[model samples]
Target: LAKTTQPISMDSYEGQEVNITCSHNNIATNDYITWYQQFPSQGPRFIIQGYKTKVTNEVASLFIPADRKSSTLSLPRVSLSDTAVYYCLVGVGTGANNLFFGTGTRLTVIP
Candidate 1:
């Protein structure tokens, strides 16, 4: 498993764009970058993922550089509801149960 590095915390106002970056220098070629959001007392939910280049979904966008050494998660027009702990992971496994967990980036969205 590759280790990911993220900010300890972040702050933002409502209707703002929030970008969280994760670093994984030892990532394998088959590994994919995945981000998850977890609220208090709840399991983390998948946000976005990508192997290389970029991937976007309804909630966020994932940008992966050519080296796959790092990735950034972008959230547009965030609200207080988006406040949560965001985690970044690098792995080739599929399914929620197969994913590994680590300390995540805590995002605080203010009104």
Candidate 2:
């Protein structure tokens, strides 16, 4: 598994855009990048996943550079409810046992 690193925390105002970046220097060719968001006690929810370039969904967008060494999770127009811990994962297969998670970034959305 490739080791991942992320910011310990971040702050953003409501209605603002928030970006959380993760680094995986030793990423493998088969590895896929994934991001998850966790709110308190609830299980982490999938935000986005990609193997290269950029991918977007209704909630967030993931940007991966050509080198595939890192990825950024972009949250547009964040709200107070968006406050949570965001995790960056890397792996080759699906399912919980296949992915490896980082320490995660704590995002605080202030009204």
Candidate 3:
């Protein structure tokens, strides 16, 4: 498993764009970069995933460098309801045991 590092916390005002970056220097070839958002007392929800380059969905966008050692999750026009703990996971499969968790970044969206 690739160990990921993310910011401890972040503060953003409503209607602002927020980018949270994660670094995994020891990433593996088969590993896929995935991001999840978790509210207090709730299981993490999938935000985005990418192997390389950029991938955008309705909720967020994921940017993975060619080296695959780092990734960024971009949230456009964040609101107070978007406040949560964001997790970056690097692994081979989507199975529960395959993914490892780290201390997530807490995003506080101010009104």
Candidate 4:
């Protein structure tokens, strides 16, 4: 299990592109980077995952370098509704027991 470090908070205005980077210096070869977004009183939802290079979905894009020790989650043209806590998780693909919770990056979207 690799520990993730992210900013304590971030602020962005509506219609802005936000990129949140996470650092995992102790990542393992079998580890993958996974990102999640959570709203108030709700569980975290999977945003994206990647091993290397770039992976994109309807909502966000994930970028991983060849070293695989760090990742960036990119949200395009965010709105006020996009404000939430974002988490970066680094670990092998296992069951729930392998998951570790850490302080997430609080993203505030302003109008």
lDDT of each: 0.88, 0.93, 0.91, 0.89
Name the weakest run of 10 consecutive residues (lDDT summed) in model 3. Answer: 93-102
Worst 10 residues of 1 by lDDT: 93-102
- TM-score, every prediction: 0.91, 0.94, 0.94, 0.93
Which digits, one per residue and each the tens of the lDDT, describe model 4 over residues 1-111? Answer: 588889989999999999999999888888888999999999999989888999999999999988887899999999998999999988886655446546889999999
- CA shift at 65, candidate 3, in angstroms? 1.0
Q: Which ten residues in a row have the lowest lDDT in candidate 4?
A: 93-102
lDDT of 2 by residue, 6-110 (tens): 999999999999999999998989899999999998999999999999999999999999999999999999999999999999988554565678799999999
Model 1 misplaced stretches (Cα beyond 4 Å):
93-100
User: Which candidate model has the greater lDDT, 2 or 3?
Assistant: 2
**Number of the candidate with higher TM-score, 1 or 2:** 2
Best by lDDT: 2
Report the alpha-carbon TM-score of model 3 versus the true structure: 0.94
